[model samples]
Every structure is written in structure tokens, then in C-alpha cells.
Target: MSTRTIQTSAYGGMNRKLRFNGKMKSREIIEWLREAKQERYYTILKFDEVILNSAIIAEVLDLLRISSRHGRVWERVSLEFCEGPVDLVVSSLVLMDCVRHLFLASDKIQDDLMDRLSTALRISTSLKSLWLLIPMTEVSATHLGSAMKYNRSIDKLSLSGSNWENSDDSDSDSDDDTNDGSKSLRPKLFGKQNAGNSPVENQMSPRDAAMSLALGLKYNDGIQSLDISCCDLPDEAMAPIIDGLVGHPYLEALNISRNRCRIQSVEALGRVVEDDDCLIRSLDLREQSPHDALEISPLSFALRQNRSLEALRISHNELVDSQVLELVDSFRGNASIKELDLEHNNITEKGIPDLTKYIKELPSLTKLLLGGNAIGEEGFNFLESLEDDDDSICTITEEDLRPAKPRSTKTAKTSKSTAAAAVSNNVSFLTGIAE
Candidate 1:
């Protein structure tokens, strides 16, 4: 952790500003200095953490000829907290210098810090990539919308642990009734303020904002990758978001796992995948189950039109025999998709013949996940047949089928001994099978 010192010109034409460039190896210092100076003097200055102080931030703002106290230098700058509240203000001023990439993670973002952040967003037009790890939970959507309205530069935004719910126990009595209904489980809209509150609620759920921002990106051409996992959104909440993504040409990857999204959303998402102009390359919708069985008819429609999608993941759903057969059949003509994950489903031994029949039609199928299913020894034999060079229609080998064996067999008894023992054990637990 040796600190490397570098002298560079400050943003306001201040001479020989002392800045610490950490952990430079022995011979790389000269190359680093040359590369550092190759950019505009202001760009170099903004990267300098020493210039992130209030005096230097003010000087940089004035030098940029922006009169507002809230102006941005670059989209990103890191300032370690060495002091108190004043340091936080200095950091905000530095952030205001530009708005594209802002990574402000400190212990100070509690009550007053969010207010400053809202102000910063209002003034920072170029801000795109925002990673704020703060404690503030009551973020007003109006203020966030106001900030995002003029500023279209943000493509990736991540906010952690900001889902602040009401602290008052008065709402406890309403919890049971609210929890009883499926309608109450819908993802709550953040940034909407309670009546009479001047400041917006800090409890901006990341998933809610992610869905909004993703919808917003449909009009905006800059955003490409969106990761909103662990945000606590349900499948119903994602349906509209998926619908909004039908024609987006710029979006590439979407991760919406570990949320409450279910099979219905997946079914709806299949429509987006069917669009010819859709640019999605990877879609992750794991850990969401449908109220009923998962259907693959919509996915078959997607496979017919979507040529750009390279990977499709729909793990942890209750996929039945017919659904698996339909999905495998859909991939027969789809050469673009290389990876397919169908883990934690119920694709049985009875479905293996149909599964392999259509799987053999996919020439580009590289990685296949069939774990936590009921594919038996006969299914494995069918998979092994695909390993041969003469079986040019299928490219997967015995190695690809090896990892999926043990897990799928835990429930299904392959041998007579195991089956008899299982029946006996169940009988001892319950005398009548009819029970």
C-alpha cells in the first residue's frame, strides 16, 4: 500500500498541486505520468483527489465558467472520509463538477447527505453512472425524476440498502390485512412523498428505480447494461418493465433475479424476445416461480424472431415435459443462442426422448444446464449420443451431461432395491398409501 506522489496542474490553473496516486510500481510512474497529462488539464485535475476539497472544487467550478455552486467536473470521483460533515460537502461540490460517474460511499450519507445528493443531481446534467452506498431511505421520485429528466448520461446506477420503510409502528396493525392480499405485494413506488413532507422519502427501492430507469432508457439511447438483482421486485412488477423493453435496440444485458418476479413475467418476457429488433444478449430471470406450471409457448415465438439473443436463462421454474419439449424444439432453428439454462425444473425421463430429439437440431448449443430435474440414465445415454462427431446436429459432449446426473436422481429411484426401500419407509410413516 505504498503511496505514489504525482505533481499535476489544478483545474483553476493552480500550479504544482500535490496529489497522491496510490500503488504505482517502480517502472510504471513515468508511463502513468505521461498518460495522466495526455488528457485535458481539467480532466487530470478532477481525477486528483487532493483537488476534491472545497477550495479546489470552488476553483474548478469557477474555472469551468459554471456559476452554480452545484456543477459537475466528471461523472466519477472518489474522496475518502478523513474528517466530518464539511468533508462531505466538499465531496458533493466535487461531484457537481460533472455528472457522468459518481461513486460516493461513506458513513455520512444518513439524513442530510441525501438532500445534498438530490441537489447535486439537479445541477449535474451529464451524470449517468451513479453508485451511492448510503443509509438514506426516503428518496422522492419527483426529485429523482427531475434530476433524470434533463440528465441523460447515466447508463448504470446502483444504490444499496436504501429501502427504508416506515419506522412508525402505527402501520403494524395494517400489516396482516396488507400481507393477505396479492395486490399488496406489488413493488412500491419510491420517491413519492407522504402528505405535508417537504423532503421526499429516502426509501427508494432499487428494483422500483431500476424498472423506472430501464423504461426511461427506452427513450434514451445511451444505456446498455442494467443489473437490478436483489432489489425485491415481484414478477408482476416486472411484466410492464418487460413490455417496455420490446423494441429497445441498445440494451444488451438484463439481470432481474432474486426478486419476486415469477413465471407470468417470464411468459411476458418471451414476447420481447420474439421481436426481431430486440438487442438483448443475456436475460437472467432465475428464482421466480409461477403460481402454476411454466409454459414455453411464448419462448417458442421468441426463438422464431430473435436472432441477436445469445443466452437465455429461465432457471428455478416448474417447467414440465411439454414445456421443455417446446423450448428444445424452438431452438432447432435458433443458431444465435449458445447457452441455455433450464435448472431446477421438472423435465422428466419421459421427456428425454423429445428433449434430445429437438436438442440435436440446435448446432450452436454449447452449455446446457438440466440440474435438479428427473432426467434418468436413459436420458444421460441420449445426451452421450450427441457427443459423437457423426451426430453433427448436436455439439454437446458427455462432459456437458456429466454434471447434471447426481442431483436429478435423488428423488427418482432408479433401482428396484431403492424403490422397494422408499415404499417401505413411506409405509412405516403412513400405513395407507391412499392417505
Candidate 2:
């Protein structure tokens, strides 16, 4: 009797043949695509620093579309380019058809380039979120309105940049304009407000354009969170933007940290908070310190009126002990606030007593950050005393304040060496907030 044998192909043998063309790396990409096809989700597709040509991006988008069945339910897509023409024309039909979360970051974005991109985004009816990271000066009012025209599904928008301040030399000719046969180049404090006009209308400033973009999106129902951090916006520039948040009912989180915004802008924002129509739950106005001569009473007044805010972050501001006490006092009787961050402020022992009193009174507060302040062992002791007396304060534990054993000199040296090695290897230590 002769023995007969049967052989079966690998588990994904057919799929591999159909997609990968028998190469291992290509097969992996194919496998990922197949998985994405089935799942209908994509996230964090970071391609920054790579000089990809227009054709390559088109191919990538095509592959994404093929995997996603033409982006019917794809969730997140992050495309970052460091060097390229910000405007790269593709199949407009395909680009306009995408309905998903889109995040675009580039270093060389220009007004004209953004206008074209905005035109494409305007047609994406299903876009749920839009994040644009570019130099703030590059963004114009025309581009902003065009991008937001048809984007009704977007619920979150974040725009970040580093250098937004125009150099003084650029405005040097303004002094001569007043004496010459030309009109003064000074910006008007209050200009004609046109409901239908672009923010860039009538020689408006760059800051005005930014404010217009923010205000333009106020009526958009899909917007829930807006973060415009590190944009270098000064007090005068941020005034209109702060005022624009008045009627934004759906806005929950607003972050304007690491900018040049002052107490005056914050006070203006406080005015927005007083409006019942504003639904902002969290406000981050960190890293903006007021000049010594400026009065701090307005900030306290603003905090008192912002009853709906649940989280307040005012870290890295050089707040005096009295101001900190006043701020903490304002939060008393307000129950919505659950977190307060005053880190990096020069708060001392004098401020701790008032802070402790406020914390004890605020029944809803769960997280309090006083890190990087002058509050050392004494402050920790005060917190410990409060914890001991109040059993209801369950969130923060004694372990959080307990100091770890001091590292030995050798161990410290070794750790530093390891960190240096990691830096040399280009390893990133960036991590998101823990949920």
C-alpha cells in the first residue's frame, strides 16, 4: 500500500500573493493594509522630515484609500512634511472625497499654499477633527475661512507654532509713513466689524486674522476642543481671540499656553467665561507672566466669575503670594473645578496656608499640582495634615508625597550617562498624559 500526503498553504497565503508580491517587507505592509481595511481606522501616520514628492503622497493617499475603502470610516490621519512646496496638487476629486480626521504639519506653509489646501478641506464633509501645525504668520484669514467653509464635522482643532512675532525692523518704515504723503501704518484699536468680511479685510493685522479664524469657528457645532499654544501671541493680539470665545457653547477645553499673552488677555478671557453660553470646562493659560507694574486684581475677578470651568492651569506665571492666595480664595464655593495647576509659580509658605484652606473647602478637587514652587517639605507637611483630618480626600495619598531614597553618586552618574547615550541614539522621551 502506497502512502498519500496532502499539503496546505500558509494561513494568509492567498492574501500574501494578492497584495505583497512575495517580498517580506512588502508582505508586512500588505498585512497592515488588510488589517486597516477590516478595521477602518488609521492614526498617527507621522512622515515628518522626509522629502516626499507630490507623486509619493498621492500614492500613499491612494494606498490609504484602498485600505479604507475610500476613507468612509478612517479615524485619524497625520501627515507632516518638513521640506516641500506646501501646495502639492493631486487628484482634486480624490482629495475632496476624504471624510475623516486630518492633521497636517509643515514647516514651510505659505498663504497661497494654505489657500489651496483649505479649498480641498472645505469639500471634506465628514472630517471630524482638523489640526494644523505651521508657523502662525503663514496662516491668513482667507485660508482659514476657506478651510472651515464645509468642514462641519470637525470637533477638535489645534494650531501650534513657535515664532509669531514680527521683527521690529519690519515696522521701521511706519514712522516715516506719517510724515510722508502716505497714511500712518499704525493698526486701528477698533476697526469696522463686518459680519461677512474676512478678518484680513481693510489692512487688518496678523493677530486680527488669528482672532477672526477662532471667532469664525465659534458657531461650528462639531468643535469641542481648541488648543492654540506656543503661538507667541501678545496681549494686544490675543484680545479679540479671547473675546471670540464668548458664544462657543460646545468648547470644553481651551489651551493657550507658552505664549506672550498677559493678565489683560486673561482678564478678557475671563469676561468670556462669565457668559452663560460658553461651555468651556478646562482653561490652560500657562507660561504667561504679567509685568511687575500691572495690577493682579482683574485676574482674581475673572476667576471668580468663571463658574463653569472645571480645570484651571496657570503654571509658570510669576504670581506673588498674595495673588496666589486671592486666586485660591476665588475658587472657594465653586464646585465644578476638579483640578488646579499652579506649578512653577513662585508661591511660598505664606501662600500654602491659603491654598490649604481652599483645597479643604473645594470638595470636588481631586488633583492639585504645586510642583516646582518654593513649597518644599513644609508644604508637603501641610498637605499631609489636611489629608489626615479629612477622610473624604481619597484621591491624593501619602505615598505621593513620600520622598524616594537619594540616588548614590555612582548611580546618578550612570543614569546621566545612559540618558546621554539615548539622546545620542536619537531616542525620544516624549510621552502623552496618562489617562
Candidate 3:
């Protein structure tokens, strides 16, 4: 169907799409906000690296607040900036009346923008959520740290940049027949500093940025959740952050995924988690350590002793049956941790029964996510039989669990091998939390 036809049927013939030329017009945005407000619908403005004029943003935001007062738009509007932009921030929009979820690519943010952001974070009471994609400069990081020092408005601060972004291009049919294999390193930090910039100005070392964040966390009260996924942090930086997070009053959720966090550093955090005073409950330690066997013992031992943790995600760390058994043993008869996420692990059917044993031992087991495993139909059925209802296996995928079949055609085999070779050749380019 045509877009106009779809809109006519969906919105009673209302025009919501905005066509921008050089700049995003405030008048156009104001009208969109008004229409969306009157209809009680959502309002979203997605820009493709377009230049965002502070005047336009401020005017639209002010108009949006008025529209909400007159019964238009939802409580929050989404402004997402994909693939960093050469941005300019005149002043912090913190004084703006409307609530907005802002996503800014760290690599794309310019110098002036950082200053404005710091100003906004320092004073703006309207900034609800902020997402800073990695590769921001040290100055920007320090400014961010200063902004979050005492401010209590922001609830979520995310810097998670996972490898393998969403791709739309079609794949070429090629295959690799050889058994030659190699492990690809995690995604590296994005973007390079402009020429002539100082070392600290080039890109903020995760360690120094983390130290600044630790300073902010010491005084932070409003932000309750923090995500630093794919942000490279050496042991020196990781250790301090763990030490700082021990008794943080407001921080309840922490995502340290893909930070090159080793078993030793995690052990330090685990020791703190054993404390009854720690407030953090929801934790995502997915792909933190390189060695699965090393990761199992320390964190599991900590979980067994902790009393506050309720939800844990530990996916993509190459967990085998034995390691999973050790983890399950830690959770067995535990008082906390009702939800467990074991996605992207190397688990198989042999470990299912051991994991299931905890279902009866601990009455609080509510949800279990087991996708990206090698479980077949029987394995899926067996897992479904664990709990009284099948609702707990929401993340389980039967296709991922099924056993691999022999190639039925030469062409198919060739294509598979070719893709593997392509990945192998370009593996060095793939970015991760560690450079």
C-alpha cells in the first residue's frame, strides 16, 4: 500500500512526516507535536546526521511543553542520534520544560556541544535520560563526570556499544571448507581523534574516564542505572570503579559488559557484593571475561553469599556444561536471584538437568533465558518441562538449540565457507570494548 494510503487509514489523513532541507524547522516540529498531542499518539524526530541548531531544538522543546499543557504529545519524546554527527550545542537545553530521551553518539559530538552538555547536565532539571556512545574525548568525559556530581534528575546513563551493528546489505554466497579457525577480538573503540589533538584530548582512556565517573558516583544520587558496555577499560580503571560502586546509594543497575573485565577484577566486585549494604541488584556481566572456567568460580561463589542480587545476565562468555553446572550450584537453594539470563553460552542438553535441579531447590526461580545454545527439539521440550508453565523459556530459541546438519548442497557449503573466510580476513576491523 502507498504511504499516503497507510497514513489515511492509520491517522485519518494526517501528515506527520517532516521533510527537512538545511535545518529542522521549529514550526514544522511544533505542528507535529500539536497533532500528535491532540491524537494522543507518540512523537519521534529521527535525524540522519543532520545539523541540529540549538535555536530550533529550544523552540521545538518549548512549543512541545506548551502542547503538552494543552493536551498534546506523550510525557517524553525520543531524539536519537545514530552514527555520530558533527554536532553543535549552543547551551544546555536543561532549562527546557519538556522531558526528552536524548541519544548522542560520542564520536560525533563536537567541542562546543560538550560544553553545552556539561552546562545542561549541571543545571537542566528536564534531562530525563542520556546515552553517550563511546569514543568521547577526555575533556568531554571529565565534563560528564562534573555534570553528574550532584545532579539527581537523570535516571539512566548508557554508553553500551556492542560489536556487529545492524547491517542491511545482502551477503555474498561463499564458503570455507577448511577447519582453520581463529578467535576475533572484541569491538575496538570507534573513531580516531583529529590531527594535532593532545593525547588526553585524542580519546578519553576508559580508565581515566572511569575514574571521573567514580568521582561522580561518589556524589551521584539521581542516576540509578549505568551501562558502560563495549567501553574499553583496563584493570587499573575497572578496579577503582568496582571499589567506588560498593556502597553507592542510588545505583541499582550496572552493565559492565565487554569491558575486558577479568576474573580477578570481577572477584574484587564479587567480594563487595557479598556485603549486605550494597544496593545494586540487577547486574549484566555478559562477556566480561575471556575464560569461561575462570569466570564461573569467583562470581558464583559471590552470588551464593550475597543477599541483595535478584537478576543476573551472564551471556556470550563461552560457558560449557561444567561451568554452567558450577553456576547452577551457586544458585541452588539461594535466597535471591529469581531471573537468570544464560544466552549465547556454549551449553548443551547434558547440562539441562543440572540447571533444572535448582528449579525445585529454589522456589523463586521465575524466568530463564537460554537462547544461542545447541539444544535440539528434545532439549527444548525438556527445558519447557522444568517449570510448571512454559512462560519462563521466553528467550529460548529452538533453532539455536538444534544440532548442526551436514551440508545438503555444494553451493551451500561453498557459501558458508566463503562467509567464514570473509569474516576471518576482516576480523581485525571488528570493534569491541577492548582496543
Q: Best-fitting candidate, measured by lDDT?
A: 3
Q: Tens-digit lDDT track for model 1 on 1-435?
A: 223332332212443221233233324434333443433333322231122444433433444344233332532343332223433543345354543454443323244555455566545556556544332333433334334444445665443212223223233222122222322211221222334333333344434544554454445554566554433455655566566667766778776644556556666678778777778888776545433455557766667777877787776667888887877777678778788888767878888887877877787877777776777888777877666664333322321111111111011212223222222322221122101
**Residue 155 local lDDT, model 3:** 82
TM-score of each: 0.57, 0.67, 0.67
Candidate 2 lDDT over 253-291, as tens digits, reads 887765567666867786777777767888877666532
* Candidate ranking (lDDT, best to worst): 3, 2, 1
Better model by TM-score, 1 or 2?
A: 2
Each model's Cα RMSD: 15.2, 13.1, 9.4
Q: What is the lDDT of every predicted structure here? A: 0.48, 0.53, 0.55
- For residue 82, model 3's alpha carbon misses the true position, in angstroms, by 9.8
> lDDT, candidate 2, residue 92?
36
Q: After superposition, how far is residue 53 of candidate 2 from its true place, in Å?
A: 3.3
